[model samples]
Target: MTDTPKPWRIKSARTIYNNKWVMLREYETVAPTGADASYGLVHIHNLALGVLPIDDDGHTILIGQQRFPFGRYSWELPEGGGPQELPPLEGAQRELSEEAGLKAAHWLPLIADVHLSNSITDERAFAFIAWGLSADHSFAKDSSEELTVRRVPFAEALKMAVSGEITDGFSLVMLLKADHLLRTGALPPELAKRMLAGS
Candidate 1:
């Protein structure tokens, strides 16, 4: 689709459902072809956060859990949602610690304002690469979650990502982006050397 000024003109809008985290809205609109259309949009209230925490030993952490929406097990990098009012980095750091039980001494922004499933939802994600990691036993995983954490080599994670083993779009984007940064000399030499050792 081409970007245009007012491709879809909204005639009327109404909220269908809303909760603390998300709100669903219905819109009556005129399409690009001037045809009447109805569009449903899910608005996420929180900014999605994802972190690829790499330890000094060339290992990165992943979390395994049963995704409620999909009703299946998923392996993904440490991820969660953060309040929109706070800085995204704060949320990334918090989720890295809470979900993976580890925190990093260094952080690199991989990407930001990532639109996930934009066709139906306005969910945005921010991803970071965290290195110089150490243990933090104060993990406070959400009570609603039953998570399994796995520490894997950076290379293996890359492989899993490319092989479709890591299916979460947020995690997949972060992993591939990290790999691209590392390979393209975009990362600090010291960090790249250490992480690439596992590949």
Candidate 2:
């Protein structure tokens, strides 16, 4: 007689807490790959957005914000995460307009991937690259935000990221990826020059 595979099942799933920005969940499930033992897991799923704004002058827009958790200020790209169902490019557009009042005439998908770490919560960050950026007359910001937007040379952004000045994981990843794109001639000439100059 052949042995049948046992289906993994969730013993219990519960939400420990719920808030505006995140939810905490506790789960108990039978081990899927091993014996009949059960296991418990805790996960916090947070939604986040990231943007890469490349100006015609070859510069990129960034922001400097004070993170209360870290008790220090860090350089970051325009980004946010929430429950809104906007598409990735649309999210980038919203973040750009809200944070910097800049809009892109051209946009493309940079990456969409999971950001999972053993030490931190399980989440995913979506990144987009935008071009032909122009500043609008006004920016509508959320009440909780205290952001300072700045246009910096793309190369300098990479240097700061490598030096740990831009420790925000999403920003670091986006900048590094942008740099790779620039080096590979994947980015426009104006943006490429600006990225190389590190303005």
Candidate 3:
């Protein structure tokens, strides 16, 4: 049997800053081949919770907002991460309330460690599924955020993802994963009907 490859062992790790949203670390590592390397690391604060907020009738709530970096509004979920790591369910509930003013009756941990393949930073996003929401709540957005929350069926969200309208990597991963869960009976039964309703 072959041994699995292990990452170079870290000789030391130093915290550069413990910020509100991310913790920066500097690490020194000694490689198997006797090479030494240093890397600056970012530990994201929140678990990167995304809520596929669903209603009894199986509709999802989506948000379209201007991402200053992207220079346009893109469809996405209510998500954020920082030092305040609420339980996944509470995080999902809070994001739903803050972004869409909705509260899900049920929440499930879907998956974790979804990477943004194109980023220079090595990061992961954790996703969840929220079900049995009553209705949209009035959003309380950040001063910099200009968003318009939109409600759509899950089926349409899937199409948007397929067509590239949903460009955020984390959001795409979560919704698609939620779909997979549905197929395998991992998704909440009450939440399953909203999957990308064909327009």
Best model per lDDT: 1
| Model 2 regions lying over 4 Å from their true place | 1-9, 31-46, 82-84, 116-120, 137-139, 188-194, 197-199
lDDT of candidate 2 over 1-199, digit per residue (tens) = 5988766677788887777665666666666575454343335444578888877666788898888888998789989874446566666777888988888887767778657453336666788888778876355798877988888777777788999878888888898888788779997676567556655
In model 1, where do residues sit more than 4 Å from their true spots?
Answer: 1-5, 137-139
For all predicted structures, in order, the TM-scores are 0.95, 0.81, 0.80
- Candidate 2: deviation at residue 21, Å? 1.6
Per-prediction tally of clashes: 0, 2, 9
Candidate 1: residue pairs that collide: none
Report the lDDT tens digits of candidate 1 across residue range 36-137.
Answer: 999999999999999988888888998999998888899999999999999999999899889888888999899889898989999999988899888775
TM-score of 1: 0.95
Which prediction has more favorable TM-score, 1 or 2? Answer: 1
Error of 3 at 152 (Å): 1.4
lDDT (0 to 1) per candidate: 0.90, 0.75, 0.72
Q: Which residue segments of model 3 deviate by more than 4 Å?
A: 12-18, 82-85, 113-124, 136-139, 194-199
lDDT by residue (83-173, candidate 3, tens digit) is: 3445566666667888887777677777666666422355556667777676655556577667788888777888889899999878888
Rank the candidate models, highest lDDT first. 1, 2, 3
Give model 2's TM-score versus the native structure.
Answer: 0.81
Candidate 1 local distance difference test against the native: 0.90
